[model samples]
Target chain A: MPGEHPQTLTRSTVAVRSASAPAAPDAETLHEIHRQERASVTGAPVTAPLLPAERALLRSVEHAVLDERRLLTATELSALAALPDSAVMALASLAHQVRLTWCGPAVEVEGILSAKTGGCPEDCHFCSQSSRFDTTVKATPFLDTDEVLEAARQTAALGASEFCIVLAIRGPDERTLARILELVPLVHAETGLNVAVSAGILTKDQARRLAEGGVHRYNHNLETARSFFSEVVTTHSFQERVDTCQLVREEGMELCCGALLGMGESDEQRIELLSELQDLDPTEVPVNFLNPRPGTPLGDRAPVGAWEAVRWIALFRLALPGVILRYAGGREITLRDLQAIGMTAGINALIVGNYLTTLGRSSADDLQMLDDLRMPVAALTVAF
Target chain B: MTQLPAADSAPAFCTGCGQSSASCPGCGRDFDPPRYCSACGRWMGVTVTPSGWTARCKEHGEQHSA
Candidate 1:
C-alpha cells in the first residue's frame, strides 16, 4: 500500500491498449483501471478477476514480502485470507519463501516444563487446569528447585534451545514471585538454557523482578481478539493481559506471545487478533490450535482442519514476517500426519516433547522431521 | 557451584528464629513463618542456610537464591 503507483490507465483504457502508449501498464495500474471502470459502470467497486495460477492479491503480497521484504498492510492481509482454494498452494509457497528470507532455514525448538500444575482459579473456557472444570488433571504442588533444575537439564539434553517454566495461576503473589526470582538464575547457571516463564497476569514489579533475575523472555498470550476475549475468559479483562505484555516490554524482556486457534472464533476475529499481535510486535508467536480437552467448557468444540491450520500459519507468517512463528500445542492432534506440511507453511519453531496438559510426540521424532525437511536445528544462542 | 540440600528433605520451620509461626522478614506480618508464608497463605516450601535460601511455592511454583 505504501509503494509507488503509475497513473495512466485510469484516464484512458484505449491509450493503455495502444501500441504507441508511452509505457506498458503494470499489473497494479491495469487492475486499478478495471476496478474504477467497474465502479463507474455498475456503481460498485469490484476486484479484477484473477487467473487460476495467478492470484493477483496473493502475488502482490508475495512480491511485497519475498522480493521487496516489506511488511504487508492489514488490507492486503485481509485480501490474502479471501484468496480462493486454487491460490492456497501458491500462498503457502510464497509464505515459505518469506520464511526462508526473513528467518532462514534453521528451526528453533523450545521445551516447556509445567513447574506448577492445576489449582488455577481463572476459568478460561478452553483450559483443563481451571478448578471449576471436572477434567482429569490433578492439582500438584510446584516442583522442588532441584526437580525443576533436573527437568531443565533434561530439556537441554533433549536438544531444545529454550526452556520455559510454566505455572498455573491467575498471577504470582509475593512469595511466588520471590520463588521465581530464585529459580531463574539457577536454571540458567546449571543448565545453560535460555529460561522463559508463563506466569499468568503479572504486575509491573513482578515483570521487573523477572527481568532482573535473568529471565530471557516472558510469555503471556493475548489468547484471542479483544472483542472475543470475554467469551474465552471472564475473570480478567483483555486490557489486563495487554498491560502485562507492556510491562514485560517496559522491563526490556523479550515477549513470546500468541493465541489459540479453532476456538469457535470467526475468521474476521482471527484477523483482528493478528492485527493486534502485529502491533504488539512480539519476538515470538506461538500458534496453538485448540485440542479441546475433555471436561472443559470448549471440550465439545471441533479441532481446526489440517488445511485450515496450514492457511492460518501461512497467513500469520505473511502478517508477521519477521516474528518467530511456533508450532505449539494441539499440532499432533489437529495437523495429524500433515505436520511436515505446517513446516513448509511458515512455522519456524516448535514446542518439542510434551505440552502442558497434553502429550506431544517425542523430541527425536521432531528432530527427524526437521532433518527430513533439510532445515537444521538452530543453536540455543542463535534464537535470541 | 554451591550445592543445596534436596527440597523435600529441608526443614519446614523458620531458620532465623527457629519458630514454627513467626513474623515474615519481608512484610513484617505474622505468618506460619519461613518455608511457608501465613499472611499470603501460600506454601513457600523453602529452606534457609548460612549461605542463602532456596524457596518454592505451590502457587508460585519455583524460586531460588545462589
Candidate 2:
C-alpha cells in the first residue's frame, strides 16, 4: 500500500520534471535571457529597437537631448546596457545628451602640479607614487610656493580654466599647508585660475581652510565602488575617502570625485561607483582610465578599451546629469582615435597636457582636438 | 614616538611646530593637532605617531619655507 502511494507520487514527480525540463530555447528566448542578464549587469536596460517607456524616460531627462534616466540606486543602475551593439549605441547616445546638458559643448582644460611628488605612505595599488611601491618616480619634498605659483601661471597662460595642486603623501603637514595658503592667494592674484587640490586624506578643519584660502575645488576620489574598494587599496578604508569628500562638501568647496576604470573591477562595480557619485552629486567628476603605471599592482592590467571609455563617460553624463565630467589621466595613452569622440560622448572637461608623473597629450593638441570636434571652449565658472 | 617603547616618553613633539605642546600652527586654536591643524592647515609631511596621529585638518596648506 505504501509502495502504491509512492508510485503515484513518483509518477507526478516525473510529470512535473518533464514539464520543468530545460527546453532547447529558441533563438528569441535565448536573446531575451541574454538581454535580461546584460541589463542587470550594465544597468542600461535593453529594448526592442526602441521602446516607448525607455524612450520617454530618456526624452524627459533632457528635453533638447536624449540621455537616458540614470538610476539613483546601485541595484537599479546595475542593469543598464544589457543589450548587444545597437541597444548599447542607443543608450550611449542618450548618455551623450545628458552630458551636454551639464557640461555644455566645450572641453575645459586644467593643469596638474605634483606639488609634493612621491613617497605616499598609503598603498593605493594603482598609484606608482606610493612609498610601498618601487616605482622610480623621484620622491621629492613639497615644492616651493613660488614654484607652484609659477606652474599655475603657466597653465593659466595656456588658457586652462583650473590648476590642480596634488601631493603624494597620506596628507600634508602644517608647513606644507601654510605654503599652500600663501601660494593659493598669490596664484589667484597672479593667474586668476581656478585652483583645485588633491592632498590625500583631509580632515574637516583642512577642508574649511582650503575653502577659505580660495581653493575652488577639492578632489577626493572614491577610486572605485564601495564593493570593489578593498580589492584596490587595503591600507586606507573606503569610508575614509567618503568622510573626506563629505568634509570637503561641508567646507563649501566644490567636490571633484571620480573613479579609475580597468583596475580589474567588474561592470557592476563601475555602476556602483556611478550610483555612489550620483548620491553625492559632486560639482566635478574626473574619470580616470587606468594606465596601469609600471611598478604598481595594476601595472600588468591592460587599459580599458576605447568604447568602454566612451560608454562609461556617456554613462557618467547620464548619471551626473549636471556635473563637470573631466576626461582625465590616460586619455591619450588609452583612447587614441576616439579622443574627440569623447567630447560628443558626454565628456565636457579635460585635463590638458601632462598628468602627475605621467606625460599626457600637449595643451596645443588638446585645443586642436576641441577645434576639430567643433566643441566650444567655455570657462569653468562655479559659484565656489 | 617613543625612542624605544619607554611606555612614558613626554609625547613626541611636532617636527613642524617644534614645541613640546605645539598647537596646529595654522589655526593656533586647537590644543594639540586633531591630526594636523585645526584651520587653514595644508598637507604637511606625514608623521608616524606611536599611536597614529589625529587625521590632519582638511584645509591646512603647506607653508613654503623661505
lDDT of 2 by residue, A200-289 (tens): 788778888889999999888998999989998999899999999989998899899988888998887788788788778788889999
Q: All candidates' lDDT scores?
A: 0.74, 0.67
Tens-digit lDDT track for model 1 on A177-204?
A: 8888899989889988889999999988
Error of 2 at B27 (Å): 48
TM-score for candidate 1: 0.74
Task: DockQ for every model, please.
Answer: 0.02, 0.02
CAPRI tier of model 1: incorrect
Off by over 4 Å in 1: A1-54, A379-384, B1-66
Model 2's CAPRI class is incorrect
- Give the candidate number with the greatest lDDT: 1
Q: Pick the candidate with the highest TM-score.
A: 1
Q: What is each candidate's fraction of native interface contacts (fnat)?
A: 0.00, 0.00
